[model samples]
Target: MQAKAFDTHLFKRILKYTKPYKKRYYGVVMFAILLSVFAALRPYLLKQTVDDYIAPKDEHGLLLYISMMGIVLLLETLSQFYFVYWANWLGQDIIKDIRTKLFQHILSFRMKYFDHAPVGQLVTRSVSDIEQIARIFSQGLFMIISDILKMLVVLIFMFYMNWRLTWIVILAMPVLVYITRIFQRKMQVAFEEVRNQVANMNTFVQERVTGMKIVQLFNREAIEYEKFKDINQKHNKAWIKTILYNSIFFPIADIISSLTLGAVILYGGFHILDGDKFTTFGDLFSYTMFIGMLFNPLRQIADKFNEMQMGMIAANRVFDILDSDKDVQKDGTVIASHLKGNIRFENVVFSYNDKENVLKGINLKVNEGETIAIVGATGAGKSTIINLLNRFYEINSGAIYIDEQNINEFQMESLRQQIAIVLQDVFLFADTIHNNITLNNPNISREAVIEAAKKIGVHKFIKTLPGGYDYDVKERGVMLSSGQRQLIAFLRAYVNNPSILILDEATSSIDSYSEELIQKATEKITKNRTSIIIAHRLATIVNANKIIVMDKGQIVEEGTHQELLKREQGYYKNLYDSQFALES
Candidate 1:
């Protein structure tokens, strides 16, 4: 599906979005054909007024011809308005549908996809590239079709009036067509560059903006700005290429058109002077209008072709995402209705890149309602265990089971619903605390949220904030403290009352006061609930009935705190002594 050619496959797929708006699509096509007919008829009426009505001084017939021409003009004007309106209307609606589906598709992708795909690039495809796709309908495809239809109608009239003059115009068309084909290929390539640069620029800006605090902390503003300028320059260069092609092609087209029209006029005059009876004043006048109609559309076709080319390029990028096979596999049919919290991983081997295993071959188990703590160095695969249990990323080998039922057999949604996690870096939407807590789930009422908040002792902390439950967290909860964000995340998890709870370094990076609040919240949530705590802070997980120590993607030790301390040369003992020695 090279954009240089017709791209029939890509074009048809793009138009498939209009399936729901079939009536509007038909109306636009009908209007385009009607407008073309009405357009050609105007010149014919002008020729009639001059030759039949005004020539012999018949005032009544001239007035009737004038009325008919005016009516055709009015009808053409109305049809053009509706034609443009409908096309644009269809474009906006189609893009709306595409953006929504793109978003949903993105959400359904496996966690591994996000690991490599830049947030900025995805945003560009969803927002900017999708906008360009709209131009296909609004300014590209149908507009080009209408222009082609008008040119066809004009050529028919020109030949009917005087074939000799029509031949003059047709002779110049091949050169114009040759130049147009060349221009289309150039602009298609240029616009493809433009789209790529836009995605790069978007990715840079989005990352820089999101990480502004880090940028300032690292004092890299000047470096980042220089990098942006480089990307921006490339974006500007791409647009200039398209502009250069347009500037060269259009005027050449115009000159060719003018010369052809001039040839028609000269030929018509010479014939009249030589007393050719067929070349009448009416024929000359009608031919002049016909040439205008013909050449003008030819010029617009080149302009509209660029728009369509850019649209095709954009549509190609969007379809890449829509057609992706990277989505999470959801083939299971079993509904995981209240899980009993039993979890086991047997000979599980997993890797994000498949080049190096993040979790090596291992076997582990936790009985229903048991509490276990996993302590490991950074990159020791502590978080990988929780991720596998949640099915955020499917394991590469062996299998995981919940209550002895293979996790793969359980429907993804229902299985996930039974698990709740509070991450170290909690992400809160720029919305009210209440909405963030319940995640706007209609089934979870504000009353239930407040009750859950009360149960976890976070109720008073939230009420202390201005507007309390209605307080806006702002993007990623920037308006709230790190502790406050974690507290909200806790409420979010507790409101769902998930059967399995995992706390992934939830207490490491917060103030002592917030840690106390979180500790209390954790105790309430984990009471008789299956809990797995992954933490670097040995103090936080010492009370667990069992503690597993990991080293280089494998579990090296397993025991309670007292039992682990008894091992003088164990991995857990060394890690614990080193961690607490620094604190002391």
Candidate 2:
């Protein structure tokens, strides 16, 4: 019922990802072919020894034949060993390559893509999906080739011994193929359901763990447990159906194989007694052994058919992500030679989706070495403006220029490197304070990190902890207070020393005393750079060089603090009055 994910176009495209491993893949194929040939040789040699040497008591012939068979088997074992070892290595490397590319591709997508997609589903597509593909490549693909080769070799030898006897044995071939096709179709449906249920279970676990504190506070443990149990039960039921189909397939194939063996024995025995045959006792004995060898591989191929189909579906999903176009792509072969920190937005129109506009024909400009404040009601597109400037999303129409050159003309990485943003919501990795501050910048020294921390007023507080800069902030920096986290976020932004800075309510979470400290540090940080602050508290930005008032995605007013305050009939006056009333 879910739209078919098994797109042939996507499958062929994904095969291109294997181009780098051609040598290893060829090695696996050669080894499988050799192993199959050697495996088929063993029964034929045994039959010759049993029918001729053992019956006539020819000691020399028996020893020579047994020794040759032993050597063949030893070589086969060695071949299998390398096949498994190198095949595993190759499969892992391919998955690693695919996952690395997939991860980078997802990161390159526009912010709206992440906003609309689930984090857990992305994680599953990256990890679980790739793993499924690897299993098919390593086990399913290699085994299939080997089994088919071995089956063909056995069938050839069986017919060579006696064509009439071989036909008697293979009369069941049509039925075997028919039954395997049915099982393939049935198990494909059931196994696909199993895979979907597993992904759902994964999503459930991720969500519950992320919100565990909220669940505990509300005392909804039992309810959450019941929900998880229901999901788990669905997964269990899907798996049961898969097992049931698989279990029925092998037995049915086995019954048919047994019937073939019985027919061979009865028919071949009659020919031997009548002396009206194209086969001898030894030939019939060897032929039946060859027929027996075909069963295991045939049955295995039937089983792995299900794995192949599931893997194809997963590969299609993964490649779909990898093949997605970058909507916020860079352009031109030019790089910005100089950035003077000046920024201008020219009649920009933008939206996450085109159906509705988040920012409608907004125009504004900021000079180098100036501080501009943006104040507005919630959902008034303040942060959306920041998102546009940073090129997290492309404008629907109109151009934004930096120092007179359109920002889109410069390479994306180079443009972003010159800018830094400190948001109201701070996120810290579960790592040490030093790593969090430097953020793995190889060129950033410890002294530089500490200086940035001191400038932002987090140095003294960090040193008071027992581990100092080595202190670990677990899980989004939950170990620190809101103000402390804000200070760290500021230091992170300041450590980069960008030419342009965007501070979106950087001091909104701190108390008055800490806010005063932050205000001093902020003023020092923004002195000679372009600063755009989305101020939550109007007082913080009252001293800004310019203040822009926005309403419903339009900039209705723009001027210095004194100029805007003196204006008649503006949104700035009402905002200032309401905040003053609330504080008083």
Which of the numbered candidates is closest to the native, going by highest TM-score? Answer: 1
Clashing pairs in 1: none
- What lDDT tens digits, residue by residue, belong to model 1 across residues 1-584? 34545688899888899999999999999999999999999999999899898888899999999999999999999999999999999999999999999888888888888888899989889988899999999999899989999998888888888888788888898888888888877877887888888899989999999999999999999999899999999999999998899899888988988898789889989998999988878888887888888888888887788888888888888888888875656647899889889989899999988589988987899989888999989999999999889888888899999999999898888988899999999999999999999999999999999898888888999999999999998999999989889989988999998999999999988889889988888888898999999999999999997999998899999999999999999999998999899999
Task: Give all TM-scores, in the order shown.
Answer: 0.97, 0.94
Question: What TM-score would you give candidate 1 relative to the actual structure?
Answer: 0.97
Tell me how candidate 2 scores on lDDT. Answer: 0.83
User: Which 10 successive residues of model 1 have the least lDDT summed?
Assistant: 1-10
Q: Runs in model 2 with CA error above 4 Å?
A: 1-11, 217-223, 273-288, 326-328
- At residue 20, give the lDDT of candidate 1: 100
